[model samples]
Target: MIRTLTEKEIEISGEKKIYGTLARPASAYTDEKFPAVLMISGSGPLDRNGNGPKGKYQLNVYKELAEYITKLGFITFRYDKRGTGKSEGDWISTGMWDLVDDAELAFKFLQNHPQVDRDKIIVAGHSEGTIIGTALSERQELNGLMLLSGGVGNLHEFTTYQRMLTYQELKNSKGIKGLLMRLLINEEKAETKTQKQTKKIIESNKDVYKILFFFKQPAKWIREHFAYNPRVGLKKVTYPVIAIHGDKDGLVDPSLLEELSSLVKGPSETHIIKDMEHGFRFQYEQKSMVNVKKMLKVLPSRPLNPDSLGVIESWLTKYFKADVSSDIKENA
Candidate 1:
């Protein structure tokens, strides 16, 4: 039987009461302190189950994975990212560093839970969550990490590729992404005729300026992203890790999956699922929201990568099964 589990909204670090959920096998009891995972969302403000704005696809993914983990003898805690759903904050205001620290906080929170094995904590991150997951695990308290649809390339490069991929398809049409990128990157500032005017008016803020000045070409940020390198962060990940990539994923370069595994300095594994996309939806056709439509059609309970959930569940089990020891070598 699927147990509803426990949850509480916690206010941490900012003016946000993060919505958190803990799921376990129905057979579990207070005395049964089990291995638990802290689930973190990617770049956006996702709800407790991984859905966006107010969706449940992410929740489905987390629950299904948690169910499998529960059946395999584990528990899971998935939370709504700040600024989304029951959480407070504006998605636009937070950056990567802010996101990473939140995941770390989740870990710290889970550590105090009575039902969780204090030492058996795994941080599972999907897409952007992967980056935050890696950063958290590097701190040495987490049991391991699961990077789903994680990127091995740089953030700047990935953002550009994503924008271009979508832009190319809609290029002929006003190309809103391109227009927005231009507004953020160049044309608006160029139109202003001076950095002072550019600084005051361009809603992008000073961080954008620092990043732009890094390349000496604020307008050339696209170039930096086009060549963005995630190797720096990927290399920094030195914990028990698993990187999963869906064969059907159109957003990320699938070829980098193996490379990410090789780059990790610890116990690691990679599973490339045959027909999954960014949302873990099965391949239906190129660029169709039909998969999402099909997913949403599934209703109140949703599942992430319906076709590949087993792979994620299994890998998680194998990792948690690793012997725990502070004296153990940090690198597996």
Candidate 2:
């Protein structure tokens, strides 16, 4: 029988009181400890629930994964970053390292929880969270690591590729205005000329340029993100790792899975989910601006990719033994 899970709102004291939720099987006894999983949300101003205010997308992918994993007899902990959701701090001033530090604190918090088996802590990160998880694994002795939709290349190269893809999409959609704007802003021209063009664009189409290019992005965070190489952390991680990517992810290329798998020092596995998108939702159709817009509009009702969850569940069940009888047991 599927056991019900109980969730409790908790706080991790750090630079600030980080708000989080701890979930475990409802039937768990008071003295029973369970294997724990820490869920890290993707980049931007996303909350613990994995919901971002930007755009119309409301896919709570991390929250859904936490629920699913909890059902499989694991204690799950997920929280808002220092600057997002109920956590305290300014989102604009936080950089990649700051976020990593927050995650480290979250890891310790989970490790010390009364109902969690400290040695069985697994770190699962989505998108940019993968970088944080990798960094955490390097510092902490984690049972396993999960990377979902993470980039294989450095941040600068990934950003460039993403811009190229966006430009291509605009060109294919006959978006002459958007394409021209992207070219003018991104071209390696003289600084004075680029600044002049950027100012002119901002003056002419303030709303569109802001929404398309600079919307909700903080300068400090972007600069740090571009400088850090995720592979550096991935290489340092010695724990068992699994990297999963959606075949149709437009943001990060799926081919990076091979590169990521090669860097792991421990047992590593990679899977590419067909028909899945960057948000871990199944989309059988190929890329198109209209389809993208439609997907965004329907994100609130979209379901998590069952195949992706199956891969994760199987990996966790294989690598880490859940304490089934005494509340938790190591997989032998």
Q: How accurate is candidate 2 locally (lDDT)?
A: 0.75
Top lDDT model? 2
Question: Which residue ranges in model 1 land beyond 4 Å of their true spot?
Answer: 1-15, 54-60, 164-230, 287-307, 322-332
lDDT of 2 by residue, 1-332 (tens): 13568899988887777898888876635878888999888877788888865533567777888898887889999998777778998766677777888888988988888888887899988888887787777677888888888755655565555756765666455467666755655434544554564444434422123435555435456556666777887777677888888877777766677786678788999998988887888877775433566777675576878999899888988888675663332221
lDDT of each: 0.59, 0.75
**For residues 25-99, could you state the per-residue lDDT of candidate 1 as single tens digits?**
444235656677777776655676666654334335555555555555566777777677766655545555556
Most TM-score-accurate candidate: 2
> How far does residue 260 in candidate 1 sit from its true spot (Å)?
1.5
Mark the regions of model 2 whose C-alpha exceeds 4 Å error after superposition.
Answer: 54-56, 174-217, 288-294, 326-332
Listed in order, each prediction's TM-score against the native is 0.69, 0.83
